[model samples]
Target: MPQRLFIDVHIVQTVPPANVNRDDQGNPKEAIYGGVRRSRVSSQAWKRATREHFDTTVPEHNRATRTRRLTSELAKRIVHDTKLEREKADRLAGALLTRLNLSQGKKASDTAYLLFYGNAQLDTVAALIAGQAHDLAALDDEKLAEAVKDLPVADAFSTGHPVGVALFGRMVADIPKLNVDASVQVAHALSTHETQLEFDYFTAVDDKTEKEETGAGMIGTIAFNSATLYRYATVGFAQLTDNLGGDTEAALDALDRFVDSFARSAPTGYQNAFAHRTRPSLIAVVVRDDQPVNLVTAFEEPVPSEAGIQATSVRRLAHEYAEASRAWGDSPLHAAATHTFTTDEPRSKETAEALTAAFGDRISFDELRSGLRERLSAVLEAQG
Candidate 1:
């Protein structure tokens, strides 16, 4: 029953945050994240990147699966169920999306009708309102689910299956496609590869412009100081596989393409970043231009001061992946890979250096990656 599955890869950026303050309503009145001054990258920007990655990576076997528009479908379903006229339904759907704070996308992202819980719909506030109920949250699971069903919404949401990100070949056990069980796995992939958390910080500041200074942490109070954050995250295939699934050759291929494109296409305003380009192209052949993938790696340039054992392990992983790719027509199953993340910046070693510090010299670099992948895969399988 293993359906041919495809992977869903996403990335989020947390950088160039602005400092500021917020009011009682939770709308940020300020911003603060990084120690110094930063720029603002709306949540829309990050989501746009994610959509771009999906759009560019759909392949021949998965052409039917690539979708960037779910908003319209949602609207259609709502109109049919709510007994509203076409225009009214459409407008209502849009307003609901806004009110619910859903589909917060950037101009660059594609978010027309994407919804979660499979086709599983949430308890419509409209339903609650109609039934003369005060709060929708008070309803139990059955009532909540029943409240949303019998409307125009399709029953095909989730097959009573868990939702999770699929990695490598897709399908969990005999179940084709990563499902509810795969949530942790998907989370693993997302978490390991460029994750981010956003928040606002505000405070008072003294300035020549006749502004007064105050603590940046104050909320609902006026302050001159502010900061905003878009925390960034990135983990290797080992880490992703540890939680989601294996990092199959196909996934790696996509990752390879992602690294190349990302290096060239980071938002110009956010350009000047050498981090994504930490390594040189290791793929023997060039991927066709039509394909798109999201690959972020830490390419560590071999250094003389490095530990000899770890360095060899790094090289060994590359060798194994290269060999498997040719012999088996794919990357080795369950193999771990690593890249030396090198840079001139003060925090260049933060990624690689941090690992060595945490794991100590006992484990080889290759083993480190392998361990992560296997562990993640096992954990996801269990959860599913």
Candidate 2:
């Protein structure tokens, strides 16, 4: 039973529509989940966030602090080599000051590039005489590989700098211990949609206990201000989790810790958006088996997720969604059904959603379409 990374990340928010937003090219936004509006946190946002928190995000976790440290040391070389005043050198590097934001002002120009090419001691004038600029990506991988053959590797056992980390994350090298096999198979894909359960609750505190449930309100049509979601992304210890060889538990622990931090802290710009703040919604450490198998967990002799060593991850998400629903007096933004996109060789859309339901007597395609048609007719009639 080899370890793998098998994950299914579902949206636990009530998806409100953007109702209307246009693409840069002025295309209508796709309405998902039966004519509902999409929120600012769209599928793309959720997917990106999920990947980032999953410890697989490339180039994102690079330390900004070090990128700054190197900026100054490199800038000095530029001025001394060119025999120019610091101001002129600054203009050449497009750096107002070494303290300027990495990408701000015209910084991130050729000075950083010069430093990268091991020209720290070499004067700017000499480097320019030998250096030429071109699209790095345009070169073939073999060619690029050949070009870097003589570049000195770093010292052994050194805790390398952030720039090195960034360089590796950027197509230079694979992220060490990252399960690239799973990532290549999945491409960091996740979609989110909300499913509403119309229920009548008699009003009672949940059994999680010790904590008080002040008010879990009834579901309504009001626009909820914010939501506290406890999202669970479960990947198995298998699916050939090789890139992370022997670090399955560590990876899972790190992922849970990362998500916990993310839940408590809102994205930078929107920290003040919500009135009532909630931490995590809830956190659960879901220790998984080497190979995850989906058995219909019918009332077999189960030991409460192995005496809580491997807690069931999803129960917390439900509690959080309920809490957000109650707190906001409305539904939170969530995605509904996700669909596949393809061209000529597309995945079969015919066997897509509503097919099973149609066959299982839950819903008929004709009936669903006819009902939608009738609604459209009613709108058209009113318009007429």
Task: In model 2, state the lDDT of residue 164.
Answer: 23
Candidate 2 lDDT over 111-200, as tens digits, reads 332122222222322234123212222345555444434432222111222222121222212223211233211111111222222222
**TM-score to native of every candidate shown:** 0.28, 0.32
Please provide, for model 1 over 291-325, each residue's C-alpha lDDT reduced to its tens digit, 9 standing for 90 to 100. 22222121122212233423332333234334434
- By lDDT, the best candidate is 1
Off by over 4 Å in 1: 1-31, 34-36, 40-43, 58-153, 157-355, 359-371, 378-384
Q: Give Cα-based local distance difference scores for all models.
A: 0.32, 0.29
Candidate 2 wrong stretches, greater than 4 Å: 5-31, 38-149, 153-253, 273-277, 280-384
Q: What TM-score does model 2 achieve against the real structure?
A: 0.32
Q: Pick the candidate with the highest TM-score.
A: 2
What overall lDDT, based on C-alpha atoms, would model 1 receive against the true structure?
Answer: 0.32
